[model samples]
Target: GAGVSQTPSNKVTEKGKYVELRCDPISGHTALYWYRQSLGQGPEFLIYFQGTGAADDSGLPNDRFFAVRPEGSVSTLKIQRTERGDSAVYLCASSPGTGVRSGANVLTFGAGSRLTVL
Candidate 1:
């Protein structure tokens, strides 16, 4: 894909159900990120994958949230026991990468998956 692509542009699920959001990053991008944005606030980082491994997952809220990037390109974010408080727009982004000391990072974001837990 020319840009980051996310599935289920809008998802409405009941509380306690499960949800999976998928993201297909741009070809050749080594860095992929997941973020969640609440009303009137900026996106909050959920996880960051560098290649096939998760370089950082400290932003994941709890055990109910997890993400995987098995092929280093496409990724999935799984949410279990969804709660009404979890309703938000899940954003996915991909970047060329930041080398050893490169302080610049330009990310291309997808039209986020809007999850509405009712």
Candidate 2:
């Protein structure tokens, strides 16, 4: 089966611009996640979706960041009023189900969509 897929591998925009990043998860996967990695920083969890609803969204930085998975297969992350600080590689991942294995969550990640806010 296909793995996770993200669109627009790279995006460059000026501050205050809005951007939408898309992700397509693997077939039959019920768990999906989004993470952001800033320069020199490890990827941080942004949100997690189980099916069509967001299960955990506390990681979102602010109201400017939002995500949706209306059909439980494709997800879109929407960023409003982008800023330089928001520049980073936005990664999308999916898993077979929700579980902590030996204290670590296993997931299959996309190459990522690098967003550059100038």
Residue range 1-118, candidate 1, lDDT tens digits: 8999999999999999999999999999999999999999999999999998998999999999999999999999999999999999999999988687544778999999999999
- Listing every candidate in turn, what is its Cα RMSD in Å to the true structure after a full C-alpha superposition? 0.9, 1.8
User: What residue pairs clash in candidate 1, if any at all?
Assistant: none
TM-score of each: 0.97, 0.93
The C-alpha lDDT values of all candidates are 0.95, 0.94
TM-score (C-alpha) between model 1 and the true structure = 0.97
Off by over 4 Å in 1: none
Error of 1 at 27 (Å): 0.5
Q: Would you list the clashing residue pairs of candidate 2?
A: none
Q: Locate the minimum summed-lDDT window of 10 residues in model 1.
A: 97-106
lDDT of 2: 0.94
How far residue 50's Cα lies from its native spot in candidate 1, in Å, is 0.3
